[model samples]
Target: MTIIFITTFSEVHADLAIIAHPDYQGGELTREMVKELFLEEKLEFPSGHKAIPANHASGSPDRKAFFEYVLEMSETRHKRYWARKVSVGKKGAPKELASHKEVLDWIKNTPLGITYIEKTKVDDSVKVLLTVAVFDDL
Candidate 1:
């Protein structure tokens, strides 16, 4: 038998794009607005449509980058924040999807859906509200 080695490299940075459904009528979103939306602090878009925020699964690279760049919180802090909110029955965390493809598909069919994805995955299927450059190894 021969021995083989496998090497894995972590990403140095990932460019993420905050995207919404193509039909979403809201204007460009500020980081504050995106934070509020994702945290469930604000429930509606500027257009008065109900906002439905989606997230990548916990521990995902995109999720980690989003928390660092956009939300300005560490994963532990985010979990604590949401845990408190949920414990108090105030609100729950955003919908968690598995992959970029799933998020894209969901957002495309949902008028007020919003989520983040790798910048390279962005296309006409969704409208980008913000593009963040995340520099991290998480």
Candidate 2:
């Protein structure tokens, strides 16, 4: 399971308090990845949509560019799949984590992988298993 820290804002460098775990709970992220899965595809864009997340201060310009790339990919997928216009990008309001401790708190609380219980035993035995796979949200 992937726990994502997500937030929204109307402007860059402005502060918002809540950061959600599943920002695009329904296949939004997955669709973006699939379309941009190819390295060349990452540069792809659609017609009439040119606005990228803007950075007025030029602080971490690359970060803004990356966000724009992902947002563009997501928007393209959204239009292609649902036949709707997904907003190109939203000003990521300045987001401030409630506290540095909150990150640690979330990490401490989240379970490693996920647990499934199989019941068929005379007594009972606990077994730990390892598995690897890409989890697709879409």
Write the residue-wise lDDT of candidate 2 on 81-134 in tens digits: 333222333333222223234332332343221111111211122222211121
How high a TM-score does candidate 2 get?
0.17
Cand. 1 TM to true fold: 0.85
What number of clashing residue pairs does each candidate have, in the order they appear? 0, 3
Model 2 regions more than 4 Å off = 1-28, 31-58, 73-138
| Per-residue lDDT over 1-138 for candidate 1, one digit per residue giving the tens place of the 0 to 100 score | 999997666665659999999877987788889989998888988778889999999888899889988888998998899999989878778889998889899999988899999898888989999888766443
Q: Which ten residues in a row have the lowest lDDT in candidate 2?
A: 113-122
By TM-score, who's the top model here?
Answer: 1
Regions of candidate 1 where Cα sits further than 4 Å from its true position: 1-12
User: What local lDDT score does residue 70 receive in model 1, on the 0 to 100 scale?
Assistant: 85
